[model samples]
Target: MKIYDAPFIRAADRYTIEQGISSADLMERAARACSDQILKEHPDIQQVLVICGTGNNGGDGLCIARHFLELSMPVKVLIHGHRESGTEDFSHHLRRFESAGGICESYSGRLPDIPQDTIVIDALFGTGINRPVEGTAATLIEQLNESGKTILSVDMPSGLPANGIPEGTVIHAHHTYSFQWPKPAFFLPENAGYTGSWSILDIGLRADFPGHEHAWGEWVDSSFVLPFLKPRKTFSHKGNYGHVMLLAGSKDMPGAANLCSFACIRAGAGRVTLADDGREETRDEIMHLHRNKLVPALESGQYNVFAAGPGLGRTPSAHTLLKQCLESFRHPVLLDADALNLLADDPSLTMLLPAGSVLTPHPGEFRRLAGDTSGSLEMLTLQQQLSARWQVTIVLKRAYTCITTPDGKIYINGSGNPGMATAGSGDVLTGIIAAWMAQGLSPTDAAIAGTYLHGLAGDLAMKEQGGLNIIAGDIIDHYNSAIKILRA
Candidate 1:
C-alpha cells in the first residue's frame, strides 16, 4: 500500500467531494467505520466519551456519538466549540445527533468527571493540524492523556503532524483509526508513542483523483511483493538459479559465515561457496574456501553475486578486500556488519561503492556509516541522503526495516517481530538479499523483497518458537515456507 502525506489525503478527500459525493455523507461513512471498529475491538466497554472539535473531524465524532446512541449504548458528547463555530457539515451532524436525543456539553477547560473505564474518542484535531495545540485544546488533551482512560484518535492523533517530527504536546492514543491510507507519521519511531497500534479504515472514497503516479512511500506487505517473485521453470537446473559467493567470517567468528551460507541456500540460491577461515564442519552440498585464498578466488570465480562482510572482522586486510570488491565486482554486491563498519571508518570508501549495490546496516551500523542521530526521522533523512549520494540501496534494519533507494524512494517493511533482534539475524538478511540479487532482481527490488520476506520468516518462526526462544537460524529455517506464501 502507498502511504500518502497530509496534502495528498486532503486532495483525495476533495476529489471525492467534487465527484457528486456530499461531504456529510463521506463523514458519516468514515465515522461509521470508526464506530464499528471500536465496538468490535472493545465489546465490553462501559461508556464512550466523544471529545469533538469544530471541524470535519468533529463532525465525524458527532456521527459516531449518534451511532452509539442509536445502538442504545451509553455515550456522551463534548464539543470544544460553539454550534456556530463548527463546520457546515459538523453543524449538520450536531443537529441530527441532538434530534436523536443525544446530549452534548461545551468545553469548559476541564475534563468532566466521567466513569473510570470510559473510552475517550479524540476528534479535537486531525490531519489538518499544522501547529502546536494550545489553550483549552492543549489542556483537554493533556488531561485526557493523564486520565488513565483508553483514548482512540480519529484519522490521526491530535497535535501529531501527518509527516515530519511533531514539535509540541500530542494526544497519546491507545489506538488510531485512519481513513483511506496511513499517515507518514505513523511509521516513524518518534511518533510511535502517540500512535499506539494503528490501522487504516478504508472509507471507499472515489478513485477519480488525478496523477496517481507519485507515491509518498510503500507499506511492504505480501501483496506488494508477490508481483516481484519469479517462478522456477520445470526444466531449469542449478545453473539457472544462479551461484552466490558468500564472503563472510573471521578467524574468531565462523558462525557468521555459517549462518549466511546456510540462509543463502535456504533462500533458493543454486550454489553457495562459503569462503571463510574455519572449515571444520562443512556440509557436502556447500563449497568452502580458506580466507587467505579469497582475493584470487574472487578474481577467478564466475559467481552471479557476492554477499560480503557478515563476520569479516574489521581488520585492515578485511577493509582492503572490501574496497577491492567494491571497485572490481561486475555483478551486484551487498555489504553488511563489518563492511558497514569499515565504510564508516573510511569516508573515501563511499566513492568506490558500486552502483546498484546493497547495504544492510542495523541502527548501530547505520550510525557508523551515517552520523549519530537522535531518532528514526533523522536516521531516515540521513539514510535517504546517503543512499542518493552513494547511488546504492541502503537497508536500515530495525523492527520496521526501512529500504531507501538511490532515487530517494523509501519502503517500510510491515513484517518481522521482536524475535528478530537476536544475533546473526543481519547476516541472514544479507544472504537473502544477495540470493535474490543473484536470481536477477534489481538492487532495490531485492532489498525490498528480501527485507519483507526476512521479516515474514521471523514472524512465522515467532509464532511457533515465541519471541524469547526464536533464533536467527529459525528465520533461515522458515525462508522456504515464507517464499511459498509469497509465491502463492
Candidate 2:
C-alpha cells in the first residue's frame, strides 16, 4: 500500500464531502465510532472529558461529546481558543451540542481542574496540522499529556507532523482513534510513543475518490490481503508450482536452512532444494552448490526462485557464494541474514543485484546496509533512496515491518507481534517471499504478500502456542493455518 501524506489525507476527506456526504455527517460518524470503541474497552467510563479545538477536529470532539450525552453519559467539552471557529461542520456540531445542554467550557489560556480518573479526550489537532504547535494550545496539550491521564487522541496526536517522527510536545495518548484511512504518522516507528494502540474507525470516506491512480499506503489486515494469496489448484503438480532454491545454514547452524526449506515446502513450492556448507551434513536433506554454498534449484531447464543468507556465516566461501548470486541469478532473489552483512562490507556487491531483488533486513542489518543513521526515520529515508536507486525492494523488519519498492512505494506491515522477534525468523520470511516469487508474483507484490503473510502466521502461532517459547519452525507450522484463515 502507498503511504499517504497530509495533502493526501485532506484530499480524501474533501473528496468524501464532495461526494454528497456532509463533513458534519463524517465528523459525527467518526466521533461516535470512537465512542463505541472506548465504551467497549472501558465499560466503566461514564464521565468522559473531551478537549476540542476550533477546527474540524474540535467538531469531531463536540460530536463525540454529543454522542455520549445522547447515551445519557456525562461529558465535559473543553474548547481551545483559535483564530478560526470553523463555519462548516464545526458550526453545525457546536450548535447541536449546545442545544443538547452538553457542558462546554472554553480554554481561555487555562487548563481546567478536573477529576483524577477522567479519560482525557484529545481532539485538538488532526493530520492536516502543518506547523509546530504553539501558544496556549501547545501548553495545554503538554500539561494534559504529563497529567497521568488515560488520554485518547481523536486522529493524529496533537503536535505531531503527519509524515516524519514527532519532535515537539505530543499528546501521549493511551489509545488513538483514527478515522477512515490511516495516516502515515500512525505507522512510523517513532510515533509509537505518541499514538498508543491506534484503531481505525469507519467514517464513510468515498472509496472511489478521483485520481485513484495515485498510490496510498495501507495498514495490512488479513481481510485486505487475502485475495493476493493464490489458492492451490487440484491439477497442479510439484513441478507446476516451481522449484525453489535455498542457500542458507552454516557449520553449527543447520536450523536456518531447516526453517527456510520447511517454509518453502509448506508455502506450496513445487520443490525445495537446500544448499549450505559443502557437505550436506544430512543428504536426504537436499541439493548441491556449484562452489559448495551457491546452490540454484533448477528443473526442466528453468530456475524458479532463489533465497540466500539465512544462517549463512561470514566465511570466505560464503562471501564467494553471495558474489556469485549477485552476478548470475536471473530470477528474483530474497537476500537476508549474513547475505546483507556481506553486502554491507562490499559496496561493489550491490551493483551485482538484479532489478527487483528483495532484501529483508532487521534494523541493525539495515543500518549496516545504509550505514549508521540519526534515527529510524533517517534510516527509512535512506531505505527509500536505495530502493529507487537500485530498483529493488527493501523490507526493513521492525515493530511495524516496512516495505519500500523501486517505484517509491512504502508499506507498513500491521501484522505480527513481539513473538516474531526471535532467532531464525528472518529465514522463515526469506522462504515465504521466495515461495511466492516462485509461484509467479512480481518481486514487489511478493514481498508485500510474503511479509504480511509471514507476520500473520506468527500471530496465528502466538494465539495457539504463545510467543515467548515460539520457535522458527512453529511459524512454518502455523503458516498454512494463517493463509487458510485469510482465504476463508
Per-model CA lDDT versus the true structure: 0.86, 0.80
Look at candidate 1 and tell me the lDDT of residue 141: 84
* Residue 193 of model 1, lDDT score: 89
Q: Write the per-residue lDDT of candidate 2 for residues 293-332, one digit (tens) a residue.
A: 3434332335667788888888877888778766767655
On TM-score, the leading prediction is: 1
lDDT of 1 by residue, 267-377 (tens): 877889887765535457778877677667667767878888888888998888788776766556788999889989998988877788899998888988887988888
Cα misplacement distance, residue 96 of candidate 2 (Å): 2.4
Model 2 stretches astray by more than 4 angstroms: 1-3, 82-88, 108-110, 278-302, 467-469
